[model samples]
Target: MSRFLPLTIRFADGGSMVVSSIADAKKALNGVWKDKEAPDYLAATRLVDDAVAGTCRPAVAFAAFKKAAAQQGLLKPADPSPALTMLDDLWSRKGKGPPG
Candidate 1:
């Protein structure tokens, strides 16, 4: 009955997890984060709990969770879209000489 979307948490060790609920987010936050003193981290903990109880918006918790992850360097940059990748490839070959 959680209203939150799944959130991807990328660890510094190159591992990752998808959290579907505030409970899962809390587990990921604890297991993956080391900066307990970070402002966002603290806020996420509170918001996540409140979200699960329907006392706050799930989006609020989601945003806080993501911010906390980012602050702790536990969030990975999203992969570039295929269209963007294609544009980069086309640009690279536009004026470059082939076979030196």
Candidate 2:
């Protein structure tokens, strides 16, 4: 079974959508890039995949992906998704002194 969460992704156009899995996030990001070509598409996808797979920090990976997309003119300036923010926060606290 797939783990589903109420995640919200905000778009560059001031719009947003809710998605569950990494696949859904990829699909949404791809859909946004449909009209335009993203620079280093594979890299962007890989970053997202790695983030979702817990292989890398989500915020860092997502920031890199967004930068690539924007450089390619595929996306505009926007804030990271709420889910990404939360994941990043949690990841940052992973190796803290101890659980409170």
The best candidate by lDDT is 1
Residue ranges of candidate 2 with Cα displaced over 4 Å: 1-25, 32-39, 77-100
Candidate 2 lDDT, 1-100, residue by residue in tens: 5345334555556566665555665665765443345455666678778988889776655566555555645453456788988877887788553245
Cα deviation at 31, candidate 1, in Å, is 0.8
TM-score of each: 0.66, 0.43
- Candidate 2 clashing pairs, residues 3+ apart or interchain: none
- Candidate 1 lDDT, 1-100, residue by residue in tens: 6566556787756778887677788788767466777888899999988988899998888888888887787876667778988877887789654434
Error of 1 at 8 (Å): 3.3
TM-score computed on alpha carbons, candidate 1: 0.66
The CA lDDT of each predicted structure is: 0.79, 0.60
Clash count of each predicted structure? 0, 0
Clashing pairs in 1: none
